[model samples]
Target: MKRILGLSLLAVLTLASCKKNEAAETSTATTTTEQKDPFADDRVVKQSDLVSEAKNHAETTLALSEPDFNFGKIKKGDVVEHVYEVTNTGKNPLIISAVKPGCGCTAPDYTKDPIMPGQKGQITLKFDSTNFDGIVYKSAEVYANVAQVPIEIRFSADIQP
Candidate 1:
């Protein structure tokens, strides 16, 4: 009976030692993982920083006469048009690079020539609400060589089906 008790005590000691080793290994692994950073070499740039940089490097500044337009109420299959004015409010000339419509239903026309400092330009947006019903919202993006290059003009209308 004494030999049996000794063997049982030895077994218990072995199991307890194994559990301690396992705990030690788990703690080491967790510490190693916590010490490493996934993005250690990479830096994240903020949107406000990018905007500030763009503004700082921009030669010209663009000011929109109207940023939003309301068509009020319109019937289906009606064509609506609006001219949005852009002014160069900086020391340098403003050059419009492109005008992109949000969808195929919108037609955009803009001044091809560069507007000198203190001059004005225009963007003509024509929206056809043939297939659109209910409340319709559309946007046009203007790309220019200015501080606010990609400017969005939003227009909305309550469509009568």
Candidate 2:
């Protein structure tokens, strides 16, 4: 009867040890498997050949014809357009790389060619008043090689039904 009791205790200890080993194996498997990010892209981009190490960093100045304009009143759904001149006021050539509109309702078009010193370029701003009412003000950013900070163009309108 004593022998039978001792064997029962040993069986319980063996089962518990097996369970601990199984748990450890499961934890190690999970750690070894690496998780991938769902939002990461595999695409890569290289620098363009047009980029050079010896490119000029000479600073310059820009003279905007109309830094700001005010349209007293405009009808709803009306499209307004304006042209502003940009003159290079410094020694180096002026390169207008891009014009970023401050709002989605505004669109911009500018001269792509570089302007020599004392020469000028044009920037056209088109504004749509479809979903606006009352006093609406908009602006755009002019990106050029002249200055580190881009200059701003501002315009306002009072929308009427």
Candidate 3:
């Protein structure tokens, strides 16, 4: 009878100890989860640093001498090009970062430097008409540090066989 009581007591104590260890482990997991990002409250750019960049853009202005072009009539597989002038008309310098062509058949090149106030820059677009027929039109978007975020330029051509 005494042996049975002693066994029961030992089992209860072991179970209690196991439960206490599990509770400790749960608390540790919770603490680690809450502290995952200790510096989450630090400074950050929700969208971009462009918020400050906009100030410089606001102070400058840019203009395209010609926003549209016509390649007239051309034979199929002909490669043609046009130069569009960009002028800085504001108090600050104008910077052209990138010029993105609208399609694979069109290639674009532009001034890779900053244009000072009252100065000029050029963007040349070369078009390939290998797979095009009839009347075809293409466009490009210019990214710059001017008042306008992206300036659009377009060109059209009549391709003949």
Candidate 4:
């Protein structure tokens, strides 16, 4: 009976040691199998690139007052005003601190106040295509708190001279 008891204790210790070794191996395996960052570009992006990215990020949040705007036909030397109604669909309040046109020929005006969640705003685009003719493509770039992707609200005006 004594010998049998000693053998039983040894068997229990062996089983416990095996379980501990298995737990350690499982932990090691899990740590080693952790997913690595695939796109780990450590090199710092240039200031210009950062600025460009930030500009793009702002653009994305400036949900256009309208998706597609078309000034079908306008005579030369005509100034037209088109309003784009937009809503803040992002997590943060949409701020249209500034709206810069691509060129002086086109002018863009947006709401100065910050648009809260589910709130609406407007961006009016005025195109003075006096001497300009053909298919006029205009863009209104809104500067504000935007998503990771940059947003550019664009419209087109076709002027017939």
Candidate 5:
């Protein structure tokens, strides 16, 4: 036929010149990866530097208006009592200092002073459970100032073999 229409028009001009050299190498690799952002303005994060880092973290935070304290049940050789209430909501002055008891049948008392700022305090936990048995759970460990975070208090009971 005219040499097969000149080899089918040279195979459609070699697939349209390889699709225009693969679309100019995919538009020059998407314009050089959108013009490389070297650190892109150091990753902008400034709301006045997060309000001066929340005013230097509210001047060395010392919060604890409520961590948790619940003593709901009591029976076995009953003597249980609980007070637990505290506040100093950070801005300084809540020096709880100490209050520990995880054993020894659990007993603790608090407030020796130094709770100013928004002030409020009280921490008393006394559980005797008569040498424990069965569901008796308890824990108390409050040490503060700049809040190191460890003031959990819980209690449960069910001892009556």
Candidate 6:
């Protein structure tokens, strides 16, 4: 009976030791796999190449009359509006894809049609200062088929309580 008990304990110890070795091997394998580069795909494009492509495709230019506007000392809950004139200075027609406001409190309106070369357009921005106080600054990004794809227009105000 004593011999049988000793043999059973040896078998349990061997199985436990085998499991520990298997766990250690798995951890080492995981570490090696993580150390390998994950982005091994062959279709990665360089940023410089993309920039060059953009430069080649950019055939139009967008000119803004006023890039910034300042509204002095306005009461809270006031809505201010301003218009910015945009012109196509290049030989090709200027196509404005989107006019996006930086925040939800600002609204922007613009013509959806393309602005021909030597033609003009307007972007109207309305800022709502409802629940806001002190100095506030906001911006709108204009996406167009110009040399500079995204043009930033900024507006600021001093809100009084």
Clashing residue pair totals per candidate (backbone < 3 A):
0, 0, 0, 7, 0, 0
Q: What is candidate 5's lDDT per residue for 1-161, written digit by digit as tens?
A: 99999999999999999999999977754332221122123233322333332344223334444455445455567777677778776676665544555555666778867777777888777777877676766776665554343446666666664
3 or 6: which has the higher TM-score? Answer: 3
Off by over 4 Å in 3: 1-59
Give each model's whole-structure lDDT.
Answer: 0.74, 0.72, 0.75, 0.65, 0.59, 0.74
Residues 1-161 of candidate 3 have per-residue lDDT tens digits of 89999999999999999999999977654332221122223233221233234444535788888999999999999999999999988888787765656666877888877789999999998898999999998987676776555578999999999
Worst 10 residues of 1 by lDDT: 33-42
Assess candidate 4 and give its lDDT: 0.65
Determine the backbone clash count of candidate 1.
Answer: 0
Give the Cα error of residue 61 in candidate 6, in Å.
Answer: 0.7
TM-score of 3: 0.64
Clash-forming residue pairs, model 5: none
Error of 3 at 30 (Å): 41
Q: After superposition, which runs of candidate 6 have C-alpha atoms over 4 Å from their true positions? A: 1-58
What is residue 128's positional error in candidate 2, in angstroms?
0.5
TM-score of each: 0.63, 0.64, 0.64, 0.58, 0.25, 0.63
For candidate 5, the 10 contiguous residues with the lowest summed lDDT are: 33-42
8-88 in candidate 1: lDDT tens per residue?
999999999999999997775433222111212224333344344344544788888899999999999999999999998
Q: Which ten residues in a row have the lowest lDDT in candidate 4?
A: 33-42
Report the C-alpha displacement of residue 17, candidate 1, in angstroms: 50
